[model samples]
Target: MPLEKIKVIAFDADDTLWVNETFFRKAEEEFCALLEEYLPKEEANKLLFDVEMQNLPLYGYGIKPFTLSLIEAAIKISNGNMTIDLVQRLIEKGKAMLQEPIELIDGIDETLRRLSEKYRLVMATKGDLLDQERKLINSGLENYFHHIEIVSDKTEKQYKKLVKHLDITENEFLMVGNSLKSDILPVLNIGAHAFHIPFHTTWAHEMIDDKIDHPNFRSFAKASELLQIL
Candidate 1:
């Protein structure tokens, strides 16, 4: 599990590479405010999250799915009395979110540029394929990645498959990202090195209470600090 053995370094997109969850948070706030007449903001937020979890299996993740969840939650909150105009507003919100300017995480560009020189860098993330690809291209960091792996979800099986696809053994793979649930745990479970660079805010679904203690696990506060070790 030594860093010396790592030949491929896979990075999680979204908050790890650029600003992502922040937009989602803002959207959720706006969603709750939009439904305040039907439900309290707190209750509306909770209901929206529940709706999202329930829809995950069917819709997966992305702005489109989230937009759908917002509309569905609005219907339920209003007991199916929500206005069509409100629905249209929610759709517009999602479209606006999809078009939000890409904000790169501090120092990620330089970090990735430097890492690419010595490692086979891959952008391994889970979400809507088109949206993720679009973000990558717009972030202007696409050239640093040797491969892009966009899965529906990040799991141990997917990480194993990724390692296999890269023609590397598990120990030769290292994953760096911001979420413990999606990025760290699964990679470590697959016997690969996993490093955590936590974002300021994470979606509730991706949050975990477990304090990770593993030979292959390490956590850092920022992207630039990664250079100190790897």
Candidate 2:
């Protein structure tokens, strides 16, 4: 199906607009190294991932929750023998991640600029609201989006609600993001068009092994290629 009917173009913020998963990957490496004395690097990584999955319900997603998970994992891995200095290093790592400069993906600014001219551009991202807002402001690309949504989660229900809130029919909305699980499947399931732009690094939680075939689903190697489809 052509995108002629798409009136609103929603973009995912993290890996789609700028660098995100890379920072998380780096943090995880640092965390693993910190706990290497207690457990093997591979084991430390597995334990941290488990802790993160468990804390998702209570802490949700973002650097802060991830930091907490790291601390928790450290304590558990070390049998409550974690040193104060190590805990402080973990905290500092999270802070550094939060303060990392917003690095826009190559051609993101130009792509968003071109799309904003023809469609009602909006940012649809899931994370801490304040952090999302801060990144948007610092990015200097916020003006391109007519509206922004920092959602708790991206489910079919959330997508449906968003369309209703935007007063647009499902067919009139198009979502673009890097994750097949969060950004593509949910939007397509809701009867909206979706474009998947794969980032170099992805969180394991967002990985999907099965193939997805739908008239409204498309994939691109990079965000700049969106211009060709739109």
Candidate 3:
């Protein structure tokens, strides 16, 4: 069905807007290499992923925990070879990931520009507040959004809160995002519409198990196609 009358167009940050996952992947590769002295590359990767999956609730999402995971993995594989210097380096890498602004996903600006003209574009994302804000500002896409939300988690409550704050109802709102947990599920749960634009890599912390059967649950093959519906 065509979303011919969309009013509030919301978005998820990170990979939805830019090349975020690739950085994490690169860091993960470097992280695995760091542990090669004690564990084979395959085993190091498996264990690191295992630890990340196990630490979601405790650490939540974003570079902080991913960095912590690297630190923990390095310590575990030290075999008496891990030193304070290595630990410091791991911390610095983590800080750099958050501090540095990666490139925006290709075609994001043109797509946002086209959509913004006809809808009340808003940013709806969850993460470290300051970090997410910095990414948006540095992205050079902040001006397009009239409202911005930096949430701790994505839930029906948060979706409704945006609706209430924006003075729009389910029919007028459309949440476009990459994560099923943070992007698609919550907004769709609140009787609102959503565009599920899948990313290549999804962080384990953002995983959610939910039934996706709704009239408003839309799917897209690319970010550029998002403008077609609006």
TM-scores, in order shown?
0.99, 0.99, 0.89
Instruction: State how far residue 44 of model 1 sits from its true place (Å).
Output: 0.4
lDDT digits (tens) for residues 32-84 of candidate 3: 78778789888887778888777777886678878888877776667557988
Q: List model 2 lDDT by residue over 1-230, tens digit each.
A: 87899999999999999999999999999888989999999999999999999999899989999999999999999999999999999999999999999999999999999999999999999999989999999999999999999988899999999999899999999999999999999999889999998999889999999999999998998888999868
TM match of model 1 to true structure: 0.99
Per-model CA lDDT versus the true structure:
0.95, 0.94, 0.83
Which stretch of 10 consecutive residues in model 3 shows the poorest summed lDDT?
Answer: 72-81
lDDT of 1 at 33: 93
Q: Is candidate 1 or 2 superior in lDDT?
A: 1
Candidate 1: regions farther than 4 A off: none
Candidate 3: residue pairs that collide: 18-105
Show where candidate 2 strays beyond 4 Å: none
Q: Which stretches of candidate 3 lie over 4 Å from their true place?
A: 79-81, 207-211
- Scored against the true structure, residue 118 in model 2 reaches a CA lDDT of 90
